[model samples]
Structures are given as C-alpha cells and as structure tokens.
Target: MPQNIYVDSYTLESLSNDQNVCNACRHLYIKWKNENSELSSILDHFKNDMYELMNVQVQTEDSPRLTTEENPTLITTTNHQVVKLQLNAASSFHTKCCVCVENLRDHAAKITSQNRDFIFFSRNIWIPEGARCCSGHLINQLLLKEAVDQIKPFSIRYQELSSSDVQLLLNKAQNFVENGKKIFSFDDPRDLNDDEYRLLTRVSRDNFNDFVQTSSTIRPSCSRSIRTAVGIYLCKLRLGFGYVTHQYVIGRHTTAIARELMCGGDSTDTTIIIIDRTHLHIQKSRNNKFERKTFNLCKKRSLLKSMMIITTIGYVVACIGSFMFNFNNNDAGITKDILLRNTSNILSWLKEHDILAVDRGFRDSICVMEALGLEATIPSFLDGRRQFSAEEANESRCITKIRWVVEVANRCLKQFKYFANTIQNSSLVYLESDVNCLRSHQSLSTTYDKI
Candidate 1:
C-alpha cells in the first residue's frame, strides 16, 4: 500500500464495518486478495469518484429545468470496461421524440428497425427501441435526407456494445454501402423523384404508393423490404424482364374468356380463332443432327417455330409447340400435331362450326380442322397463276382482314428481346414456358395497344 493515500469517508466507513463497497472497488479487492493481482482498490475508487465528479459538474452547468425530468442513464465503455457516461447533453428517453424532444403519450410514429438502421448508417446515431420521431420527418417509414442530416448527438456519447451488437452494426453498414450503389432507390422518395419513379416503374408516385399499399400482404424477406420487392417486380415488368412465376400459367378459364371475346362477331355466329406461326432464330448447334433439324430452308438460317393461337381482339389464347424448322414441323404439320395432341384441351374448347382463320401455310391443316367439325379459312393460293380472280380476290381479302390480328399478336410477343433476338440452344428448354407466360401477360393486360 502507498503512503499518503486519502480515502473518502463513505468508503472508509464501509471498509471499517466490512459493508458492501462499490462494484469497481469490490472487484479490485477480490482480485488482490485471491490472486495477489497488482490492481488496487484505491485506484478503482478514485476512478469512480472522478466519474461522479464529472456528473456533478454536468448537472450544475446545464439548464436548471433539467432537474424536473428524469435523468437518462447512458452506458459507456473505456479501456474495454463498462463505465458511466459524462456527457453534457441529456440522453433521449423512449417516451419522447428524439428529433423534436417532445413527449409522446400515444399517437407517435415509433422509429422502425429500418429507420433506426438508416439513422445509424447516415448519422452514426443509435436510437434505442421505442424511440420515436414526428411522422413528417419520415416518408414511407424512412427518414428523409434532411431529417437524417438534422440529427446529431447532443454531445459525444460512447456506448458499450457486445460482439453481437458490433456484428449487427457491421451488417447494417455493409447493407447501406451496398444499397448506395443502386441507381434507383424506391424506398426513399428523396432518392427517386416522382418523374423518376414514373419513368422506371411506369407508374406515378401516388399510383405506386397505392400499389404498395394494396400489396402489403407480400411479406418482406430478410434481404428486401415489401416496398422494394414490389418495386423490383414493377421494374422487371416495365423493362420486359417478364420473370416466370406461379401466376404465369395458362389458367383453365382462359378458353372460356377467349370464347366470350370471340362471340358476337360480325355476320358469323361461329367462334373465330386466328392462328399464325412465328420463327425465332437460334445459333447453329455443334451437333450435326440438331443443326440440320433447326435449319430453315426458306430463311436459310437455323430457326425454331412457335404456333400462336389468338383472339380477334389481339388477346393471345395460347402459345404452343416450339417446333424444329424441318419440313415435318412446318406450320401446317405443327397445326395438325396441336389438333391431334389436343394441346391445352383444344378439341374440348372448339365447338362444331367454329372458324379457324389462318394464312396460306395452314392450308394443309384445313382437312384436319374440317374432320374435327371446325372450319379452316385460308386465303386462295396463287397456284401457278399471277393473281386471284374477282371472287377469289374478294374472299382472300376478307380472310386477310381477319388473319391480320394473329400477325400483330406475334409482333407484340416479339417485342420482348428474348423472343426477338437469336436464342441460344441452352435456352431451348425454357422456350415454351417463356412464350406462354409472355403471351399470357398480353392476354391479361389491357395496357397494350390493340389492332
């Protein structure tokens, strides 16, 4: 023990009576007595006294009205040990808004975990649970940039954090940095203006808000918020990504809808379905058999054909059978295969006297359609003649008018680059599903222009 050391009367009295001392002094005493540690109780007591002295000074120098309110305890750390904070500003309480410092009994906008994270990432402030802010300061439960800028620690505050807390903060920081690299941020209205939202999502801000509200049941995942998930979906649709989902399937009621739309047409009680074949170019496969099978003699290229069945109103009924470009898989043969296979229950949907209006390529399937109690309307082929006679010309022109919608439907499907550009052999497996899903979208959507 050092000479000329002074001890406070409270500590001396406690020691003389062997009463419980302060935690720091008690810990030091235990270490010294049990293990002959070099730590001294007097020094421990001295540090505690200094911390109390600082608290006293802060209380005296600050506003007198502070005495009326409960003093908030702030936990701090020093030299890897827990210690009391000696800050000048009053720490915020759970019952008050940290931004305006107003007491909120109820009707407060509690700071959400996401808003708390954003505040920490932007301002290095850790808002405790149950802390709140004025609702005006937040847009979509996210702090505005101005609100984030306005936030500051009343004074320097050191917080003692465990390893898990440190790890959580690190993860938030990493996510913040990762999110910063995004070109468009939909969660923060400040990050994306109204016009920007409309440009990217093809919806105005108010409409987007309504969409988010309506889709609130789409629960947020660990990696994304509900708003962000909805925004991603909209962005994907607007950009023509057309990601496949469970809802992309052709529903059973699709035929009924097609029948309804095709009924009551001019001068004919028979249901009319326009059929056309569109070819998608593909790379010449390395395999000799596949390359030959996909070679189109007319276009002199490797190609794959998809048969489109659509309504007169340009609503695609079904996109089926991405067949090879070989003669056996010509438009007419593909039509016959569809009819024979009864794909999508085509036979059940078509009634007797139903009209299948198609171009010249489907002439071979005319007999198959007639046998199925269906009528196949094809334009008159030139057949070694320069042009059609007067009666043939008028009839062919009439058929052309009805057949034009299928061509427009094909063009609309090709608007997506996945169908318009040359496809790789690796993507052949997804061709049928992809085409059906895209056409299904066209059928369900009323936004697209109709011919």
Candidate 2:
C-alpha cells in the first residue's frame, strides 16, 4: 500500500525544502494520521469478534439439545444429555450380557423383542442389538423380576441420528405405551389374567367385571374412569379389614365341639353365640365431657368399644355399638341394652335354652338373659377369693375356650391397618356401612378359601 497526499503548490514547496510545514497543513496531516490508526484498530477488533462468533455457532450445531420436536426421546436431566436407543430385536449373536456386562456363559439367551420392550418401557434402559443375558435372568423368555431391576444404564454414548431415526423412535415409544406393560390395569380386558385379578382385588375376573357393570352409575373423574373407581374401591376394601357376617356366627349343630358344649338335657341343635368387646383407640376429643367419656381406665387412652358377636368357628356375626368407652358402655350394660332394645332382633331370634357364651364381664346380663329364657353362660368370677375354685376353673375353661374365637375374630379385623389405626371422628359416619361391607367380604372370602 502507498500513501498519497495532495497539496497546494505552497505546501508542496514547503515540504520539498524540508522547512516546517504551515500550521494549517501540519494540523490537517496530524488529524488524518490519527483517524487512520483508529480505523485499523477497529478493523482488527472486528476480525477477532467475527472469528469468535463463528466458533460459537459451530459448537452449538454439534451439541445435542432437548427439543421435543427434534429429540423426542432424549432425556436431559442433568449436565449430560441422554439419548434413548432401541435394542436390536433380530440379533442372535452376543458375546456378553447387556445387563451385567459380564462374559457370555452357557445358556445365554438372545433378548426377545418383548423383553426389550419390558426393559425399555419399565426400566427406561435400552439394550443394544445382538445382546444376550444369562438364562437365569429370564423366565419363559421374559426378563426375570430381579434381572429387570438390575438392568440399568451404566454408560452414555453420543448418537448421530437422522430424521428417520427420530421418527422411528417416536413411533416405537407410542406403540410400547399403547400395547406394552401395564400394572394391575383393569380397563383393558386382557391386561390382567383372571388369577391376577383375584389375587390383587380378592374377586374373580368375571365377578369383578360384573361388579363394575353394576356400579356403572359411579361418576367418572378426569383422572379415572368408573371402572377404575370401582376397582380402586374393591382393592382398598381387600387391603383393609374384611368384615364378618351375622348367620355364620350362629353355632352350627353339626360340629363335634358344639355337641360337647351342650348340657346333658339340652337339645343337640342349640343356637350358641359368643360375645366380646374389642377396643379401638381414638384421638382425644376437644370437648372435656367427650374426652372423659371416651377415656379407657384399663388402656389409659381415649377409646371406643365395639361389641363383637361371633361363632365357635371364628366367624363374626355382627359388630355393634362402637360406643364410647364410658361408665355406661361396659360389656354388661351394652348387652343388657341390646336385649332391652332388641337390637338386631335378638328377642325374636332367641328361643328358650339358646346359649350365649360370654366372658365374666357379661355377669350382669345373666339375669336379663334368664328372664328372656336365654342362657347367658358367663365365666365364673373368683369374687373376693385369691383364685378360682376347681369347679369354677373348669367351668370358666369351657366358656373361655369358646370365647377365644371372638378374640381371634377381632384379631383378624385388626390385622387390617385401617381398623388397627386410631379412628378419626370424621370417619364415624361411614363406620357402620363400611363394617357391614367388610363383613360380607370376610364371610365370602373365608367360604371361598375353605372350598
């Protein structure tokens, strides 16, 4: 490059003579030189900026991004982006197991398409094609439960995918969700087998379907269908306490033990019912009177009492009262009140000489039962004696042996966490209906199990 400065004759003459240029020309040259230096610096800076912008653009293009439209199956939870891959369904050659990454042993089975779907859909793990696993990890060609748990992604790889590959992945994911694994799904008829339905909900598949149909009036919510609501109810009932029924609690004459309990002159076919009271702890009420009424002296807690009537065979006949554990709600008082009120048609159901086996707590009910021509067989109390006499002990043993069934029946109900836990006051409104429903389930389930 060459620099050219045009000047008038006078300026040129002054320059040729090497004399100081005129002040006006000198100032003009200095200004021009400063402007050139600034322009050159600006150009260099612009070149460097352009280089940096180009480098950034290249890096951005190479990095994987989490765009729903571009990478539907890409999962970027942290710093590293995860690309989901599908296992090769048709590959029959594998030198090592995909799960454990161990050397291939004898009986290494090729991963089936179903197994791959199960792993990918459930475990969110992609098994590579031509992969095999030990036969022990499979059950009937499906991944064993333990093996499925062990299948986890250990390493990541950068995958270069085309548009077609991304489309294929989206299609595969949609298909797996629509037709693959489901856990206890009741909406689809084929999702679960009959036995599975029975095991989970304690109802046969046909019965469950029928129940769903019967409950069609159940309103569906946005989150669940009517069938799902019914299924959840049944499952909750099965999970909670199953109740006992009335007729099953009445003693059957066919049993040998029932005959043994009968007196010499008493008829062999006598109706015997075992009765007891079970305690359910409750939260202390805010009201002083209410809290005081519910406080139990024996347990030293606020409690409610339910009268359990059962049979010698350990079947619950009815659960009643669930009354406050007050002075007026003792076993004897509750029994007397039930008879006086003829609750559950006790007076109608009882005949002369019909036996009621109860613990000593029912001593006050003996006269009431006698007046009604019913025999209230209560365990003998020692009174002021240090111990029971031999005769009283023997008599008490007989009553206790039969009374223990009611205890066992109560235990069964309490086995469910719902009843075992303290009852909230708000739940009392539904307690009776819930108890009745439970009784029906318990009776039916027991009958079925016996068969």
lDDT of 1 by residue, 1-451 (tens): 1111112221332122123356676564444334322223323434554444434434444546544234433223211333333222323676766777777655668778887777655555667667777787777777766667666676565554432243344345445666776755677765866666775677887788788889857988789888789887775564211322112222321233334433433423456678888888888899999999999777989998888877655666677878998879988999999999988677777778877878887788899999999877777888899978998887777777556667667777788877888898898998887777545343423422332
Clash pairs detected, candidate 1: none
lDDT per residue, candidate 2, 188-294, as tens digits?
55456666777567788778877877785788879998767877677566421132222323334223455476454445546677778888778777989989999
Clash total of candidate 1: 0
Query: What do the candidate models score in CA lDDT, each in turn?
Result: 0.63, 0.61
How good is model 1 by TM-score?
A: 0.47
Q: For model 2, which pairs clash?
A: 243-438, 243-439, 244-439
Q: Estimate each model's TM-score.
A: 0.47, 0.51
- Please list the residue runs of candidate 1 whose C-alpha ends up more than 4 Å from where it truly belongs after superposition: 1-269, 383-386, 443-451
